[model samples]
Each structure stands twice: as C-alpha cells, then as structure tokens.
Target: MSANDPGHINDLSKDQEESLKNFWISIIDKITNKNKISLEDFYDSTYGNELFNLFASDNPDVVLLRRLRARKWNVNLALEQLINTLEWRFQWGVNQLVAKGESELSYQEILTGKTFYIGYDRFGRPINYISVKNHIKGQFPSETTEKLTVLSMEIGRKLLHCPVESVTLIFDMTEFSMKNMDYQHTYFLFNLLQNYYPESLGLALIVNAPWIFNRCWYIIKRWLDPVVENKVHFINNIDELTKFIDLSNIPKHLNGNKPDFNYIPPTEQDNIMLSAFQNDFSGNKKARENHQQASINYLRITYQWAQTNHNKDLLEQRKKAMEQLRDAYEQLIPYITTRTHYHRYGLIEEPIFYKTYQRIQQENQQESVHF
Candidate 1:
C-alpha cells in the first residue's frame, strides 16, 4: 500500500491479532527440537523450517510475531516489513549498535535524558522519559530518533532482569511549544513507532501536553486503532504518573527525588517471569568484540584434501558447517514482546506445540502474561 492509504492503520483488525498464537508454540518447539549438539544447534534447527529461514532473527520470535500481529497475521506482509527493517539494520551495521554506557559516545548525544530509558517499573516494564523541549528540531542526525528509540529499547532490555515484554513511555512535555515540537520529526516518529515497531509500546503517558499538542494529538488519535489510542493518556504532572509506575524509577531530573522503592513490585507479581534477555546482554557484547579475530582464524584454516580438491559434496558440507558457525556467532536481540496478540492458531494440533501453547493460553487467559 502507498503512503496515502487512508485505512492504512485500521485495515488490520485487532481480532486477527488475537487469533494467531501457536505459531509461537511451534517456534519454541522448533528451537528446542534441534539435534543434541549444543546451543549452536538452535540456528540449524531454525533453518530447517523454510517459513522461519526466510529472515534471520535480529530479535527473537516474540518480537517477530509482533510484526505479524501488526499486519493482522498476514505472514507475507509482516515478513516483508520485517525484512525491510532487517535490511536496514544490515546496511547500517546496526546489529553492532551497542550502548557502551550511559555516557557512551556512540549514542551519548541522544542520551541527554531527553527521551532516555531510566529503568524498569514495578512490573519490570522499562520506563522511558522524553523531554520534548530538549529536542531541538533538525539538531541531531536524520536517523537520530530511530537510533535513539532502538537503543533505548535495547538498553532497557539489558537493564530489565525480569520478564517484562513491553515499555512505558513518558512524554514529558513541560516546556512544550510549537518551536520545540518538530512537526516533521513528530510525523516521522509516529509512523516509525506505530508501523515499523509494533506491540512494543505498552503505555504512553503524555504529560504536560500543551494546547497545541492536544490539538495535534486529536487529529493523530483519530487515525489510531482503539487498542493503541486507549494507551495514550494526557497527564498533568509527575504526581499523576506515580499511579501507573512508582516514582522511585523516575529520574531525579524529573522531580523524582526519593529513590526509595524500585517501583514497589505489584503484590501479585512476586513470582515474575524471567526471560533469557536478562542474562544475554553482556555475553553478546563480549562476543562482538572478539568476533573479527575469530573470523580471521576461520578464514586462515586449511581445509581437508577432499574439500580442497574437486569434491563438491564435501565442499558443500564444509560450507554448511561454516555458515552454521557464522550464524551461531551473530548476535540477535533477545525479546519477549507483549502477549496481547497471542492466539491459539487452532489449525494445527502438533502435540508438543499444543501442550506448550495450552500452558501459555492458560497463563495468559485472564491477562497479558509478561514474556
């Protein structure tokens, strides 16, 4: 569809998203059923399924399914969008986009705490704060918004040790004005967050929005589906935000002085889910550092006589092994995105997948299960 498609946002129905769940169980089954070699076996197992092999997992299947939901379970459309984003990542070499520290030079320019990820809330959801006035129009690079947003999310995932799958965005529009509100950038950001990155934003608390923001948001809200529109809220100040997220995780710069509680975990959330992402960040970073040297050693290897000679079959086996190693070393962003889009995919009843999803559907029956 063209940019001018009027029903672009609403064309995909919410019901469609809720009906496609086990493809998820199938995904998990696919990962676990690989040959008993090692953790490296996961990639080869993934490749066995043609539907999955079409694109590499820059992020986990949880996030991949979100894109699918965004397109109402239309796998082809969702895959196309996913591939476009992946192609962008490959071209930019953004797969290596690591936030070294809060002060890391790579992304520090965007980490002025203006649109920065502070920490996780009580529910283990990452809480991001965006100071609109600090955002000077045309000041940063063209991809500044995109890069900063993605980095914030990646860093958020690293910081969150719990099984939280989504993020809570705080748009602090304290000094909001036409001058500070970059219309072009705002338009671009909306499309990126809504169309490109879906099922990731859990809540959007728009605080201190000026009259102009409300006017603009009014028009924008009309285009949004109710599921998204309902998440957007207008708040007066920081005090109001405390209801959804505890004040402890809020930054000191944002009038959050007492950092006593870590958003006091919900009474019912004592036994929170813990996703694999919590432990993978540091290991992934270290792997990237030595990855080049490792590649050199591989290239310098002397092959067997059969492979070196005219044996096509032997050479092909060698090539497959090489690809598996390369793929194994490549890092993918660990994710357990929002479970609201979960569906049973009632078509197939493969026993293993059915059992896994049966537990999942039960866990997520009453509410959206984290991770």
Candidate 2:
C-alpha cells in the first residue's frame, strides 16, 4: 500500500480476504436490499447491522474479517457464529439492556457488587475484577451469573471511558466452594465474549482457583475457543496479577499497597443530579423536583460565573467551567421534558442529548484551537 492509502495491509491470504469481503458484501446487500454503500443504507440495518457499521474499519469488509480471524476464518463456522450472535442480540435486547440500568433486575446491585473496575493495567487497559463467590447464589445461579457477566462487559466497554483499552476480567475465585461454580454459566459467558464482543478481552486472570475450580474447569476448558483460551490466565496468587496492574491502582482488597475500595460518592454536580434522578425515577416526585432545581441553579451559577469572570488569564479554567455549564444545562432541559416510564419520574427527552452533542462538538473544535 502507498503512504497516501488509507487502509492497512491485510494479514489474510488474497483469496481468504476476498472471501470474507464477499461474505460481508452479501450480508450488507441482503440487509439494505442494495449493492452500494450509503448513509441511509447503513442506517436501515438493525442492531446486527449496526454492530457491523460501528465496528467497521472504514468499510464493512473488516467486520467479517475480525470474525474470521477470531474463528480461524472457517467460513461455515464464521457464518454460524455471526448468525448465532445476531440471534442472541435479538433475544437479549443488547441495546436496551444497559439503557434501563440494573433497577429492573432484582439481583443487579448484588451482581454488580461482585464486579468492580479496580484500575488499569501497565499497557493502560482497564482492570475489572469479579469475585465469583460473591454473587453466585440466587434462585438460578446460572442466570444471575450470566446477567452480571454481560453487565460487567457492557459497563466496561461503554461507561468506563477507557478509550484505548479492552477490559481485563480477573475472576477471583478466592474462598471458593464447589457450589459456587456453575460450568454451564461459565461456558455461556466465555462463548458470549468470544462471539459478540470479539477481542474486547485483553486478558482473563483466574486467581485463587481452588481445587473445586478444577472440576468446573475440566468442563469449561472444552468450551473455550482458541481465541478465548489464549486470553485466559490461571494465577495461583493474586499478587502475580500485579505485573499487569500498577501497585497504586490496585485495591487493598487484592492485597495491594493502594487504599481500600472507598466508595466515592458522586462528587460532581451532574453526578449528584443523576442520583436525584434515580430517586425521582424510583417514584420519588420530591427528589425529581429537587434535581430540577439543583440542575437549573447549577447552570445559572456557571453561566453567571463565566460572564462575570471574563479574565483572559484563566482561559483553560473558563473552558472547563463552560463545559460543565453546558452539561448541567443539558441535564436541566431533559428533566421536565416528558414522562416515559411508569416507575420513573420524568420523561426521556432525547433532544437534550442531541443538543448536548452539538454543543460538545462545537466545544471540541473550540478546545482544539488555542484561544
């Protein structure tokens, strides 16, 4: 490829690359009912197609290419994997899953407690820990485990803001018991990560794997595909995990030098507003009203502060303040917009998000250029 060329050199054989490309092209054609690429064409496709569009490196060809690489490019196997994953998404409602949050699920918070974003690895990948024994007990341990695994994966990918990181999942089977182990759920979780969320797993550290873990691992081992197998690491000691994770970033629970998992209450005004929103959403009308007032007051304060303190000397600080103000104002706009959920207090006004998005874009451009 020439220096000016945009695409990267493919590691695949010419025939194989073309085959994958053809597969992608055929699928795109089927989805759009058209041969060509266009804005509307990509948009018309549903979640399955959207995954392709979002993941495509300049084109749809790479979407299948990654899947092919993940599955060793066995055409029949790749096609099966792709179709199965899309089917899973349809059944699971992958998009709507995170949008509703953990409130809908009774076992969510307990499940969430089991998984924590401890810190980042040496290569800057986010390190997430899952205490397998913590929330393994429920009416159906398998279902609970699966939901928590998916939630952890989703939160790691979307909410955590690790721009250049694939999350490292440390399955801490400390103080383990035979009953805590669910081979079916373990296999399903591994398969889910392998198929749908391809290559998001930088590492899988299995620490403190007691003798009982062997029984489950015997079954689980067979289920892991080659890609997943490569990522999996069985650590005898938790301290061994410190090689990837920095000392300070490591939580005290893991026997690291850093502080314990001190729950940092939402310090930002926006975050506080979100807490109030949750309270309001959970049938507390007063909480909703309070959130609205707080948000409005925040916006006004930031605006007045910016207007009065027009000191060119504090350009950077002013920009940060403006960004905060813009965000706070956006939050206020969405508060009283409309009513949606039977449980939640206010309506889901998407326009606030769109407006915030526009402001963010403008702010980004403004920030890029030195004032």
Which numbered prediction scores highest in TM-score against the true structure? 2
lDDT of 2 by residue, 1-371 (tens): 11112222234565564555455544544444543544344433464344432332122234455466566666667766776766676677654554444533444344345666655677666777777776555545565456656766665643223234356888888788876676666667777777887656778889888887787787887887776788888887656877777778666767777654333322354344444444344333443344334333432343343344244645454445445434443454333222222113111224553454354446658869966
TM-score of 2: 0.61
**Index of the highest-lDDT prediction:** 2
Query: What is the per-residue lDDT of model 1 for residues 1-371, given as tens digits with 9 covering 90 to 100?
Result: 21112222223334442322333333334335544432233333423222232222222334555676577777667656665654555464343444222222324444344665565566667677778887877667756565666555544444433234467888888877776767666665566566656666678888888787877786677667677778888888777877777777776656775332122121222112112233335544554444333332322231231224245765465455445434534432122121110111111122332333344446556446455
Task: Name model 2 segments beyond 4 Å from true.
Answer: 1-20, 33-42, 45-64, 74-76, 139-145, 159-165, 259-371
Instruction: Show the lowest summed lDDT stretch of 10 residues, model 1.
Output: 338-347
Output the TM-score of candidate 1: 0.53
Candidate 2 overall lDDT versus native? 0.54
lDDT of 1 at 327: 52
- Candidate 1 residue 90 Cα shift, in angstroms, is 2.6
